[model samples]
Target: MKKLIPIFILCVLSCQSIDTPEEPETVLEEELMIDILTDIAFIRAAKTSSRKVFDEKGINPESYILRKYGVDSIVFAENNAWYGGQLERYKEMFTVVKSNIEVSKIKFEKLKKEEDSIKKVQDSIKKATGDKKDDKKDKKNKKNKKEELEIDDAKNRAIEEEMEKARVKRFNNLSGKE
Candidate 1:
């Protein structure tokens, strides 16, 4: 009976401790420190990358760079000395830049292939139609329009999926309690 009484009192005290709220001032101070540390790290990264122009730009460059890179802003900020904003922007920019590069490469390849196809078509029209100018022009125009539409469709699909993934990740991160 005595042991039970002591155990009950301990449990009550433990429960009381668990219900206590964290001091607001302490949390604020910690958050401020984290912000400062993140800013410092961002500065360092910018300096290293010779992107120090970002500092002068008055925008959080690190978040921009991190976002462009397609990295999580929070993770990048937490790991680096930069704030969340710059890292987030950085990640986004990185993704856009990379995608643009890839798109350009694809466009270049398609253009090259299109040029070859046009040449072949021109030669065939001349040989088969005995130089029917209007027929060649119509066929070339149709081919160009079709290729443009296909490229536009492909680019739209890629961009939509990329944006969707980013949106989902953002939603998940925000919904988390931690």
Candidate 2:
């Protein structure tokens, strides 16, 4: 009976190993996975900031991302699972994603600043030229400017929130998850 018990345990362990799913046939490239994850992080931040807007627009972020990558949810799930099983590799991939987000934030801010400066210069020139635009045109311009500013503000907030999350994740991941 004692020997049968040991054999049963061995059989159970072997069966569990056998039940392990096979490596997915279509594995997403590491770079592509990183990109998808980065986009996901961005989407998360956007959703956090404007969940109502997304709901109103019927914007299915995860589906859109999967479609964008030409991969179905099943494929993404398989690839994600594979990566999740590899602690070190997944850590490295996330680190890359975090860095990409930082770079994006810096570039976005720089471009935004440049664009604002250019707009200011153009406005000054327009005023200096004594352009007597119609009230309708002026009103339209103001409306457009207001809309643009609002969009920019929303984006800035999302990015800032994502940056904070990234910082926290970076700290936690570095704390040794093993």
Candidate 3:
């Protein structure tokens, strides 16, 4: 009977401990850190073309994280350093980040598919609308295409010029002509 009483008291205490909320600061910091890490992972994944990776466009990760969560690089660095020694907590944060990244990737791909389907429907409707409107569209499209080609040529020339400059710089450095 004495042993049973002790066990029951221990069980009650454990349950009470479980019901208590975590410290608000710890929870907030953990969530912010997880979000920042996930955003970084998404940005890195976005650099790749594979659908298996994140494919969102025009994302400046550091700025986006700061704007969305008010958690900038400095805060992230501080919290990351704080958590570096706590392996279990760090792993937990990373697991959540990875799962969120996967969920985001799937959501983005689905949205992209929907967008492509809508565009296809719009194109079909335009094609079915007859020659009258198309005549004006054709002229506009031709002009736009010409401008695009010119812009592309300029970009290529600029890139080649930069490459030549870099090569010359490298050669000069190698020849001790800094």
Candidate 4:
């Protein structure tokens, strides 16, 4: 019985050791939270700047602000953080800013394409409808004008649809739904 008791105690200790799981290495949640907060703050600042430029100056604010501050200067300042924690925070903010610029560039490209298409349509319509009119020429001109008007109307509808799609896409991307 004494030998059996020693064997049972040994088995129990072995089972306990075998079944115990190792704890995962600690991650600093606070640091992660702070980085996320910094990124959010940077995005908010960019949105505010964009609104200010659009509302007050009738222009996109990003290039204006970048020019005002000097991109190189801002980059240099961000790179030279005095403390390690601050360096991480600055890096996070920089990433956010870069992402914002990338999204803005995509939107600008879409707008430019739409603008070019509208201009081309407008020029064609002008040329078609601006011809000199007299008798036979006047009848032909009226028919051409009607066709031009229909084309213009179609172009306007297309532009409006594209603009709406772009607006929805932008909103979705900004809201993190995309």
Candidate 5:
């Protein structure tokens, strides 16, 4: 009976499967670093632009980090904290992002200047053509001005006549004449 009991115990132990831990899910260092840095960039932008803009744009940073990088908040926070503790690495990553932004800004400014120059050229061309139209318009303007002057002269004459009549009536009234 004791031998049967020992064999039964051995059989039961052998039947139980040992779970070998899954090879620690290997995380790509580069990808993880990029995601952490991107989150930092998003945070900086959010600080300046405000949460209202994000909400209006329907961009939730938390969800964005998850959806884009497949990292949940906990993982992201862990990466952020780890990278943040590494000052040199954090600065290196920050510098890269800042330089990229500066390059884009320079490109945008150059394009803006080019656009402005083109607009100025177009405006000059329009003004040059507009001068010819203005010559014809000047004739109409002169006629309108002359008409306005004539109307003003008539108005003045009527006003002067009314003043004279009023003055004479005041003189008659003062002398006891109707």
Candidate 6:
């Protein structure tokens, strides 16, 4: 009888359910979550690469990222906990995030290479056209160069604004908001 009682008690204790965390009311979609994780990975890398620069800029990387995705810390935490409870799903999400970071790294490196090449070409062209002309011609060339720079700056700003708007729109869509 004592052995049966102890066995019954053990079975009862083992059968009791473990409390699971409640899912957030507004759980971020898996895709959005992956993107957020990827951005966090990038920021983590950047911070490690230059902690001094981040401190000087006074940028809270995590807050900036959460704001970008329109997610609150509390909700993010709840969703993260929910996702983490599913080991396989969380593992898959991490794999996607890592792949995304790797892809971004490759793209950034390619862009940097292209920019360096462009700068080298520009410098060579500038040297070849060194200020060997008359004073009046040189002044005119300088004025033309200044105007071109201004025009380029305006175009660049416009393009940046458009890209930002597009990014926001995509985020909004992913979040199921207007």
TM-score of each: 0.25, 0.61, 0.47, 0.31, 0.45, 0.61
Model 6 poorest 10 in a row by lDDT: 127-136
Q: Write the per-residue lDDT of candidate 2 for residues 59-162, one digit (tens) a residue.
A: 98989988998988999999998898787999999999999999999999999999999999999988866455656688889999999999999999999999
Kindly report which residue stretches of model 1 are placed more than 4 angstroms away from their true locations once superposed.
1-131
Tens digit of lDDT per residue, candidate 6, span 73-176? 88888898999988899999999998897888899999999999999999888776764455668899889999999999999999999999999999999999
Model 5 local distance difference test score: 0.74
Evaluation by lDDT, superior candidate among 2 and 3: 2
Residue pairs with backbone overlap in model 3: none
Q: Candidate 6's C-alpha lDDT? A: 0.89
Task: Report the alpha-carbon TM-score of model 5 versus the true structure.
Answer: 0.45
Query: Candidate 3 lDDT, tens digit per residue, 9-125?
Result: 999999877532223343346877787788878766655545443334545556776678765555556567667657788899898998998898899899999999999999888
In terms of lDDT, which candidate is stronger, 2 or 4? 2
User: Ten consecutive residues with minimal summed lDDT in candidate 5?
Assistant: 19-28
Q: What ranking of all candidate models by lDDT puts the best one first?
A: 2, 6, 3, 5, 1, 4
Per-residue lDDT over 126-160 for candidate 5, one digit per residue giving the tens place of the 0 to 100 score:
99989978987999999999999999999999999
Clashes of 5: 0
lDDT of 4 by residue, 37-106 (tens): 3444555576786776556766644445445444443342333332223556547756765676667679
Candidate 1 C-alpha lDDT tens digits along 33-114: 3443454454565576865565576676655655555556555444333322356744654455456556767998999999
State the RMSD for candidate 1.
36.4
**What does each candidate score in C-alpha RMSD?**
36.4, 33.7, 25.7, 31.7, 14.5, 31.4
Deviating ranges (above 4 Å) for candidate 3:
1-28, 46-64, 131-178
Q: Which ten residues in a row have the lowest lDDT in candidate 3?
A: 19-28
Backbone clashes counted, model 3: 0
What is model 3's C-alpha RMSD? 25.7
In terms of lDDT, the best-performing candidate is 2
Best by TM-score: 6
By lDDT, the better pick of 3 and 4 is 3
What lDDT would each prediction earn against the true structure?
Answer: 0.63, 0.90, 0.76, 0.62, 0.74, 0.89
